[model samples]
Target: MTYSKTWQGFYELLDTVYRTGRPFAARALPIRLGDEEADRAIDLLYQPLRDGEGAVTGIFVGGYDVTEQVRSQAALRDSEDRYRTLLDSLDVGFCILEMKFDEADRAIDYRIAEANPAFARQTGADVAGLWVSEFAPDLERHWFDTYGRVALTGEPIHFENQADVFGRWFDVRALRIGEPAQAKVAVFFSDISDRKRMEEALRVLNASLEAQVAERTAERDQIWQASTDLFCVATLDGRLASLNPAWTTLLGWGEGELLGRPFLDFVHPDDVAATTAAAAGLARGEPQPNFENRYRHRDGSYRWLSWNAVPRNGRIYATVRDVTAVRAQAAALAEVEEALRQSQKMEAVGQLTGGVAHDFNNLLTIIRSSVDFLRRPELPEARKRRYLDAVSDTVDRAAKLTGQLLAFARRQALSPAVFDVGEKVRGVADMVDTVTGARVRVVVAVPDHPCFVRADLSQFETALINMAVNARDAMDGEGTLTLTLTCGTAMPPIRGHAGSQNAFAAISLADTGPGVPPDLIGRIFEPFFTTKEVGRGTGLGLSQVFGFAKQSGGDVDVTSSPGRGATFTLYLPEAPAALEADDRSAAAASVSPIGAGESVLVVEDNIEVGRFCTQILQDLGYRTTWATNAEEALERLGPDGAGFDVVFSDVVMPGMGGLALAHELRRRMPTLPVVLASGYSHVLAQDDAHGFELLHKPYSAEQLGHILRRVTRPGRPRRTA
Candidate 1:
């Protein structure tokens, strides 16, 4: 009879029958059992069937699960094929165990069910169907415990051993083959010796790498300590974080003393603002160029430092070099530059003076002649008075012109002494209120403490007032003038010259005026250059201030931009003195009576000036001789020319200047009195009675007499020609 089940399933059902009375037909279908190992089917075919007539009849039919019997046979054959496949194809070792019972009905041993050839390689045993514990007695204590547990529990147990086994590490997995009550367990193992050895090697390598890192770190620390430059780290707010030993050695501060202090505390107080700003910028990730500033050393003195700063990883890193010597050299360079500039300026002025005097003296000659002719008794008193007044006014104009020239040339003399600049500025504040009209507001920002400077008191005050007036004009007489005194003790050297050292004190005069035109700022201090209309300004105001400051051993600088108002800085070298109002000069408003008598020697390259000088002296009742040059004057003094009472020489001439002549005369005659006349500052400074008395040019008859009197009368002595 045909069954509606697979052949294997039909066989499985037949195996279950014990007292079956009939044969049956069944249906069968295929079913999977193990991965690539077995298959099964089920069917209802079993025993034989009988008919009612007592003879065998048609067999009974039923659908049955016959999958297992068919599958079992297939599996056995497949297992043999797999056994060969595993032996040739698997990379890892494989083993199988079979159950063996003892005579008392207890499992006493286990046999090799079937194993691929690799099992022999794992263990040197060739015998099949034998107990693993017996074959390898060394594994009895080890593998037996896990094997028995698995065999009874029907669960898998996996183990690993990096210890050399058969010359290599091995990992094994064991499991029971049947139910929990089974005595057979299969164990599989593989070799992983290479991975284990590699791991151990890597651990050693990591330890070596750590040691090398430590060595490198020590070397780097040694190098850092040996370096000469000062390296430091600070917070964004300029609080010191870390510093090298060099900082303490060079700066005289102990490490512990420097820590937790504001980095700017070690900086000169005046430089704190700049240092703070730079640090803040660095903290915000902005790099700083090598900027010069002042820092306080362990001693109570300040020194220069130049440094570059950058912020890295939330910390400020700065490398600094002591720049005090460099700064000093730079200051010296600046002084040299200033000297050169002054020399060139003086040369130009001297040339201008010579040219002007040569040309203008001829005109003066005619004017003097006309005036002399008019002074005769024939002319009416009214016309005579008018002519006299006209001549006097013309002479005054010439004098004023010369004075302006002197201001430009910086030749005008200044009586210098120490004075308090703060009080001087304050004194001007009250005057500014009236000069600039009530509409203008003036505030003096002078410090309470004394700020002393060595300079010409009148000139300094005059320069400051001039600056204020200019500021007031810029503001149309309605703005503020703030005079602030700032200490410049630690200012960096300027213009690479020690002489160009920033003044010890700075008096800044600022105004809220419409700012100066950028184009005019540079030229404002030039003589006769002005922004005001023709009639409004002489343009000599700033030139005078500039000349005065330079002559007084100081400088003037201006900062201005369109719409930003303006500030004028008067940098005056400091002197130890009280910073209060100083006394005014006693001769400030003196009439200065002219001198009479005494023989005079006048040297003028221009014939007209020579004659004018001779005539003026003669009219004043003094003996005199005129020379066109130094050579002619020397001859006059040597007895061939007229005997001289006192020598007066023009600075610029065809042969030699008055300064050189004066020095030569000082050597020749020793006590021979000489006077130097110039319209330029270079001439005046060239010899400050390093040889003879200095006299500025463009003098009137009265001025000429006055200087002569002052020179002739030393300690109240006088002479008559």
Candidate 2:
């Protein structure tokens, strides 16, 4: 029989069964009945009837329709596939776990059975089909306990917790998936470690901020209560808003009395205006670091207050201190300074008096003794001449003593002339080597160019000698003295005087000797202030140097260190080098001393000195005329000074001083030579002689004769017949 018309699948099955001599069955096999558009599914079975040899056979089939069942199964599988895909796509992790139980029925461990892709990411590991104990053996027991309880009781749970073994925190939801006997759970979780860490940092920061705020408050309170200076806060309108306890302690005013009142009310009447001005400044946001004013105290007295204040947020924060004691101390210091100056002056005077008495008495002793010896009637000619020479030498010594005193006073007459400082220093170096002894070496250092200064040549040389002698004494005559000359330099501040930026010539003498002691350096220029033994020095050397430097428009400074050495620098204002040639020419053309009956008009206030001066001029081959005063001398000159070749006048005469007389003569007789003589004259000391020749008192007959002869030199401007 052919079943191909009924169902192709059945026909095929029957054919196979017939060929194999077996019966066949089919399930859900599609067939068309009577040419229908849709085919029907059926379950069929085929069996074949076989002969004894099992070769040829006829087949029989059994069948049933199964279209609905097949379709339902397909639909269910499609829905399951979709559910798996949804789980895999979620950000949250999802997994199914099968719990393992021990003999006591307690869930001990779990194996991951099913997982989504997110499960591996959230857990930082792919644990599917692996026991939790195998991967995370150090997992906390609480995890097992919580998940096991949920599975056993079929209870769902939601929690956020750290899994220490995984080093992460999780937000987890777990529920039993089936019957409690199944011991299975479905878990949904997400990694929450970053959220947890941020929360923890915020918590720590909040705690620290609170602690810092409390600490600052405590510190402010401590400073407010403990500070001795008055601390206060005031409004812009000048009312005291708050005050520290220092106010009560310092001004004897209670806090209540001072608060909420205009601060100017406590100010002194004389200081109220100033205090108001200061308040205005503070309101403008100006900081007043040190403003002083007086405040009325509770004791009916006024106290000086110094305020340091700043403005912020329409308020003034101020710190004030009582400065009454400071003011009083400053006044007292002023008085003390005056007293110290007076004491220093008196001490200097005492030293001068002692020195003068000591030196003069010695000189007077020689004179007195020599005069006494000469007074003997039977004195030999040789002895008489020796006594006369001794008297003359003593007089010379007295005059030198007076001159040194006058030099220290800056009251000695000076004849300033321009000369090269380098050449002068070099010249002094030779003498310094001799004065310092053979054991001491002298070094002279000078620049190639000339440095000149206008100063008294004699005084300048004397100052150099004094310094050299001082250096030798300091070295004990066994060290080196370096003389350095620098041109085009500036004066540095010395002895508290201001420095000069003007060009200057610097002459420095450095000595390798035991240096000046720090304590004595300041007073080294004080007259009679010496470190030497009593008979060794007169102590006027450095003093004369100081006076000379000051009077010559310059300064002297010394720098020293103990056990090292000392350097003394003399700074003089630089003069033009153009004067050097003129000085040299003048020095070259100097005249001889022997006079040849030159007429001299002598003006002297003392009759004895007048007579003596005339006699000396007459003996020097100069015809002399005497006048008691400048007027008499002018009258003797007869308005033109015609008869006199030179006017030898005392500088400190009674009226119309020598300087005035010289000016008068220059006006009347411009060609007549004027020679000024003075032992000590204020006019000569303070001002120059206006081109008049100067002859110092106590000058030797040779000196007087020389100056007169030079002024009377023929063919010279002042050398008229």
Candidate 3:
């Protein structure tokens, strides 16, 4: 066989085998089978052929068809190179670890035998050929145990863990790859720090979103439950879907009872139509704002509810407020406003009437005296006497009219004294009958025991008479008029007087006449207000009753229903039982004779009044001095002036009024008698005349003489009756 130059090395190997008397074998030797252009590989065995004597002979060569074997070796080398290249190119870290065990066959540590570039990069350490504990001294023992188990059991394990020392997270896969006697674990892992951070961020974001949702839900729930106003969600068909606790608190119904029920069921019968309309409007997407209706309370009463509602998503959300108390307050305010207006009207009328009455009284005084003088004419013919008599009667009528005006204005001077109201009613029974006329019956009903009150006896009788006359007119002069006396512990509130807590006496004058109208009830006590026709009644009758009652620190009230007749009750503070005996009688009935030697000072603002007063004093046999005003009176009674035994002053003077003069005189001459007279002075109206004698105007000579003598007498009582 022809051999190629590639066989020269083989021939040399064979020659050495013969010389050494040994056999040589070449596993895969390259031999040229054909020409160089088509060369093939061969494996040859070269051996020395020896005789039995063990001497070297010609070499025997053995040839094998090992072309595939040589080719297979080359392929294996290529595969190994590819594998190493694949491992180096991988992004994941890779390592082969040999697990070391203790005497107990328990895994203690792991030695890293091989590591790829990725492993070094991930761990930030060059750890090949080093123990895992050496590379990461603080590595967990669980890592070694896990890898050891995988090597012993030939099981592959996958896990994720953080490397605190390297500040990295990794996803590691450990597998047994070598023989069990020399156990080795291949660990493949990746640096998963970015993925872990991303996953953590996503988790935090989801948690935050969940927390926000929870917070919003809680806020919505809080608002729904905590609101005081009635809050509800109802379907467009009026079925209540939800209601807050306020509905239970305000309407006295449980939430379960109200929800899922028709909302209109709880509405007041009269308000149901309106509530239904409002709901219909809300269903049409038109917002109902401040719509008002009444709802029935659990107590069978109705409460006003104001509602605001809107429609959204086939539901009506509504809020309601209870306005029952607000409505009541508004009504009360209206009543108060009306009462205030009536009071103002009465005040204005009182001022006007009071001014007129004061002047009218003075004129009546002049006329009455002139008429009295004319009636005493000695040359009186029969016709002249008749005319004078008529004049006197007319003067009397004019004086009575002025008195009524003064009473209506509540400015009349009241001479209040303690007297039995029962006796007074009995005593005035005849007068009340006369005023009521024969067509009417006057009945006096008095208790057996005396009921005492501090009031002007004359004015009290007059008030009784005036009420009788008014009742007579109301009944057309044909009804029963009853005057009854009773006592009580407390009295109801009146216009000018607060309600009383003390015992009081009542003089009730009930008449079987037509009752007063409801609309006119409040106006009945007002001055000059009347329901009768013009000329049929003076309208001052009830006014006098009202004024007299108020002036005596008491009040008069009337109760009547239309067509049921009327009763007028006069409430006055009861007098102490002890005072009833002393003040039982009226002011001394008979006048005393004038004090002949006494001097008198008459002070009057009106010239006619002054002259009349001084003339009466002179006629009563007293030396008199007259002053036109309080100042003039004070001047006449000064220390240097001709002083009088007693000083008389008119109360309603222009400057330095008589009350002021009396106060000053009392201070200077405490024992000196001072008498003040007025038709209707503010001082008398205020009930401030004390420590001095007071005489009302339009007094006759006899009354003046009696008062003057009583005041001028020495050692007189400091306080007069």
Candidate 4:
């Protein structure tokens, strides 16, 4: 074969071998084959072409063709170069591990047979050809077992694990490489340090989110379950969707009973309309900040409920409160206010009446004494008639003024007894008619059943008469006067008296006449406060009625509208069934003239009154001594009152009052009979004249004589000296 330029080096090698007569060798020698575009590889062995000699002549071209083998080797070398480049460029760590085992087939350590550049970067150290225990003495045995198991079982495992030695985390995939007897594992891993940190951060964030969720949920639940007020969620259709336990606690109803039911179901019938209206407002997206209505309880009683509600998202969130007790307290407060008003009114009236009564009584006493003298039959006929007529008119006016004063003062002695008010009203009907006149019609509208009251009979009659007169005057003496008597357990509240819860008799005198003006109605019951002309009225009629009703443990109320009509109602407490009428007729009988020759001491503050008293006593066959005041009377009676069989004294005196004198006389000589007299005195009004024989003022000679006989009667009980 002809050698080409490519074979020149081989030919030179062959020439040398021939000149030295020795063998020649050529490794991976190239040869051109017939001008082909490819080259061939060969490993040549050249020996000297000599027979039985060690000398080499021409090279022995007997070597096998290594072209295919060389090509394959070159290809494999290129591929291995690419693989090393790829491994060095990768972000993952790559290693090949071989497990070392003892004779017992137990693996105790692992060796890294191969490692990539990334593996060194990940571990921060050289690990190839090093034992895992030498690199990290604390490496877990699982690493050895995992490699051994992969080598022995030919199974692949993918896992993530931390290598604390380098404070790094890795995601590793291991598989058996080569034959099972190799006991080697090829592992591909990623240095997940940054990924591990991110994962830990995500875990902490998730944990914080969960904690916040739990905290919010706990707070919401606490508010829902712990509130005492009725917290509820309801639908737009007025149905209760859910309610707190307060529903059951406050309304005496279970939650089950309230939920799913229309909210109006619990409303009282009278309040349903209002509640429905409010619900409509809520449905229209209007919030009810405060709404009140009565709700029926489970026990059938009604309770007042106050609600504050807001509507949103087709539902209502509402808070409710039971206000029944608050309502009751408000009512009680109103009643107390009314009672206070009444008491204040009475107090004001009492002060006014007491202020004028004392002076008016003195004037009346003078008029009465003058009238008594003018009535004597010894006077000339014409003079007697004229003086009697004039005096009689003056006495009438004086008596009326005194009566009014006593009535307004609430000191008119009342004989309160159980009497049928219906009967009393009937008895006074004729009198009321007479006062009202023929122009006015008097109608008595009493119930068939007797309405009995524990009040003074004459005062009740007088009250009726006063009311009648007021009605007649209001009507201008032409309207209908209706006297309606009603009996019931509840009476309207009256000024100056607490409303009685017991049965009461309401005698209302309604007049179809021009009513008193609204402004004057309150003052109508005030003494001397009248709407009539000054000379036409004393203004004490209504005040008398008020005083009498109040003193009798009752009250009077007036309803009037200007230019319309007026009503005067008297409320009297009812009496028990088994009441007996008082016998006042015996007390009204005239006194007997049975005075013996008894000595008397008369005390009077007025000069005329003192002389008249002594003269009357002497004319009644009683030895009399006169004194201008209680002090003089006591002096005349002496310390032991030896000259007096009875002591008579005026109650209201200058130096010492009769009551005080009586007390002093009793202390000095208790056996002396002392009598006290007065037209109107504060002491007599207080019932402080109990120990003495009380005599009213303007007493006649016959009355004085009778009183003296009674006091000086023999064997009568006398106080000891």
On TM-score, the candidate that comes out on top is: 2
Per-candidate TM equals 0.42, 0.61, 0.50, 0.44
Tens digits of per-residue lDDT, candidate 4, 1-721, equal 3345767776677667778776767777776567667667767787677655654435565665788777656655543443443344334567778888887767888888888787788788897998878868887777677788878887777777787677778776676655677787767666677644111000000012322443333423433454445667689999999776767877899988888999888888888888888999989999886689998889998889778777765777676766677799889999999999999889876766664575467556766776676768686778767765665566555655665667667776454567888888888998998888999998888889877787767778888898898888888889789999999757766654457678888899999988877777667888876677745676778888987877777788988887779989988888876455555334434446556777777888888887877777777787777888776776666666756678888888887898899888888877778888788776566453555777665555666777777677668654322
lDDT of 1 by residue, 1-721 (tens): 3333345454544544433544555444554444534444545445555557655443444545566555554554443343343233333455566655555544445667666566676555575666655655454344445565667666676667753335667766665654544475655566666542111000000012322433333423443454345767677777889787778877899999998898777788788788778877887789786867898888888889777666655666666767787788889999999999999789757755664575358448757876887969889888887887777766766666565556557776554667777777788778767777887777777678878887767667777777888888888888777878886553333334345555467878888987888778867887666788756666767877777766666667788878879998877778877555433223322434344567788888888878988888777666687788998788767832234568888877877777778878877865557877776545454333343566555666766766666566555333232
Candidate 3 residue lDDT tens string, 1-721: 4566756765578668877887777666556665565445666667677788988878877777767655655655543443454345444577778889887778899898878787788788887999867767877777777888887887776667887778888776665654567777766676778754111000000012322433333423443454455767689999999777777788888888887989788888888888888888887899887889888777777889877677765777666767787788889999999999899978867855774575556556766665666666584587566766666565565656667767766778776777778877887898877777899988887889877787877888888888888788889989888888888657887655578788888888888888888889888766556677765655667878887777778789989989989999988899865433552123444447576767777888788877877877777798887778877777667763355677878888888988888888878778778888877776677683664677776666776777777665556633221
* Residue 280 error, candidate 1, Å: 38
Q: Candidate order by lDDT, highest to lowest?
A: 2, 4, 3, 1
Clashes of 3: 0
Q: What is the Cα-based lDDT of residue 452 in candidate 2?
A: 80
Best by the lDDT measure: 2
Q: After superposition, how far is residue 267 of candidate 2 from its true place, in Å?
A: 7.0
Worst 10 residues of 1 by lDDT: 198-207
Q: Against the hidden true structure, what lDDT does model 4 obtain? A: 0.72
User: lDDT (0-100) at residue 22 of candidate 4?
Assistant: 68
Local accuracy by lDDT, each model: 0.65, 0.79, 0.72, 0.72
